[model samples]
Target: MDRSPLWDTFKALPDTFLAYIYAEKTRLAMAEESRHVVNENQQIVAGFHHGYEASDDQYHPGTFQPFMMKGYWIPCSEGKLFQLRQGHCSITRTVEGQDQILYLVHPKSATLFAPLISKYQHTQVDVPALALSSFRTLLIALPAGGTTEFAMVKVSLNEEIGGVRRLLYQKECAASVANSSVLKNKQTEKFTCLEENLSFVPDAHLIDPKEEAVQLSGAGMIHRPVPELFTTQGHYIIPLYALFGINNWPLLNALIEQSQTTPTQFITGALLRPIAEEMVDHIYRQRFYLEFHGQNVLLKLTMDHNDLPAIDFIYRDMGGVNCRLGDVQLHQLPEHLRGHAQYWEPNFIPDAAVIMEGIAKKVLFNLTKVFFKSEPTTRDPEFCCWRAKMTVYGYQENWTLPGADGRTDNHRTRHTPKTFYRYGYFEKIFARELLEVMTRHGIFLNIKRSCPDYDYSFFMDKIGNIDSCNTPCVEFEWFSELVKMTLPHYFQHQDAYSRRKNISVVRP
Candidate 1:
């Protein structure tokens, strides 16, 4: 397989290479276990059938000629390969002589559910091909082991559904992108379906009809790079989790130094903030929610105009994304996906908030823990104190209902800003910072409210409601209060830092 110089460079990085090795070892073990279980199950079933004199010939008699899904020919001459084994659902191999990677799906793995609702009562699932004319993104999905043919089907269906999502998201956010700086600064790439006119199918005879088959043929997606930053050479792409590896400390320090920024600043500003902004903006404007966990998101490191390291994020594996079609026009959807009930939600704010909370708790907080583990000197005692204060006093413990009835309801029962503070100090600070940034972009004011008369009391009254039935009025008011609550902590941290520097602090 022809290898890109980038791949060679990737392997040369001691930390990244070690991380890859560690992850690959685990993946190989899992794959082996999966294969073993499959084979064992097949044997047990076969033995049982033989006892009953059941013929294997009853099922898929003779040679099994599988139905082929049409896809564009992505020529990978000499079958040269550099494979990425980090993914769970599919394995990505670099396409030779092209700026693309092919995702070979795994059969008998996790099902890829199509969010589009149909007449069928059960959820629909299939693979779709994804054709990206631009940047590449990496992500890990659930692992499954199966036949190459099944992998092909999964890949095709995933790509097809993903392609539709990309198209709709781009179109829906087009006008907003032109006007919103948050959307403009945040980057994503276009995806389209491979043309049906093209004819390309892998050989079916490579697998024995009787044995468990695991080959890398049949259906797959040839995706190009997604982020424009990726198109530039010399940028290193690393998954977020990889940074947590023990062997990657030196690389992390080098990145911080190259960025000409402190570890805290680099992480909060470059990594956490950008991801938060993009996610919030997408949900607010496009009603599109992504799975922004560590494995699905990657960091692209390169240099900025100041020759300092610039960090950007890349996302992939859109199969699990959520899109609320309550306000969306049916005409905006592809003809085939129009009536899918799975994509429709009466109210999406509650779910969006949950996604935001996940980002704070799962992604940002975990990242901070790893960074602090690696760079203990960068820890801020003053910041920690401020975080603690916010955790304890930043949220309302109870909502006092109207009428001198002395009735007070615990706020924990609701999905309010207070819900975020319960996680820990990191979540408290992250929520504060994220809300601060979001409010600056007028998110609170512009968000679709559940009630026009929404205020603090109205919000409190509707607490603990179902997601589809809950009001976002509380969210709007709570977000505003949360931002206000951050001012004191921000100033306190700033004052302490300034004092330590023996400099006079000026309040903004």
Candidate 2:
């Protein structure tokens, strides 16, 4: 199909299962592609700035969730490439004052990505493209073509997103999936879960030293507890609130919903369908009520038994963080839900509206970079409306929640000072919004005719985290709905489209 999307996400599945999926998928055909952070244990180990050590295995202590650390870069000399054959990490100097984290990484041992710390022998240089911030720094590296250079580059990790690395993994998944054969049957679909929420582990999926084929690409596939398809995977976890804050993610709330069940094989895109052009306004009013430049909003793309196509919309962000639109009612919904729930989903309330105003006054115009390195120049045009409003920063990688976040450590959070994520109010907000959409824009499917044992309550309870987690509960409803609104159209589209094309049509 030549469908190499820029990103790939297979709902929620374990690392073990992912391996099998990858193998089967590769056997089918294809190619591939993928970053990192730091802390206290990192300083001591990297031999610079503050160090980080294993805090607790539960909080991803050893190789916890993808994270960030603020430390100085005590360079041995002025250089850009401090090649570390021992570990796989990168370094970025904070723009002037504001410290920003970048790339993605495995949550194994410390050194995820290095940040500019003061501990190094630094000689300032002017780099134009670098982000402007108070960290007044530029990446230090050896003046190449010499007796090779090495030092403990003050490496730090991004809280969870590990920026660049996260995107890389998504690229990998997209790459892997594009190679699948259209004729591949469901039984032979063989594909793995390329989850971004993995942890660090010793001797895990570390990349090789070959500079050309970035090894960091495979970092997310390490040290997680799951049954196989083999090949380990890892993730860049952060507060659920961070995920909810923007539109640059898969179904965040869906992740939580799926986690509520008995985890099975990893699966994604099996539930929801892609958004249609007609619903752009609906999605815009909801998802981009702010600015979801690259948000990944997904819809239910199946068809009805009568050969009709359907579309259902939901926020692609972690599942929360909507203020402008929470109060902005949906005129597109059926009359019943449009006016029935006068009280906006109790959870999607924009906390920033009230909580951040006072704090906004205290913002350091000079040290603003310390907090938002990229804010000074690339600040979103919409953000001015809030100053003009105000703001913030995902989920369980930091805390516990109702469904999935409850399994291992429901309350034992690793990061400090309970932000929106630790409390899970962010996800709470997204969940509420999703429910609102389902109530308003969602379609109905009579599962009783298809399967007498269909379970609506179970499916509604858990549908997004992973297909396994919620599939058993609502499979009938979903399938019934699938048959009723989208499947036939899907086949027709593929069939008609394929027939006129050169590819041969081989029905199973």
Q: Which candidate gets the maximum TM-score versus the true structure?
A: 1
Computed on alpha carbons, the lDDT of every model, listed in order, comes to 0.36, 0.24
Q: List model 1 lDDT by residue over 88-113, tens digit each.
A: 22333344544222323322111321
Q: Per-residue lDDT of 27-108 in model 2, one digit per residue for the tens?
A: 2100000000124343211110111222233223111121232222322122212111223332233455632222222223
RMSD of 2: 24.1
Instruction: Report the Cα lDDT for residue 171, model 2.
Output: 26
Alpha carbon lDDT at 362, candidate 1: 47
Candidate 2, superposed: residue stretches over 4 Å from native: 1-127, 132-209, 212-426, 442-452, 459-508
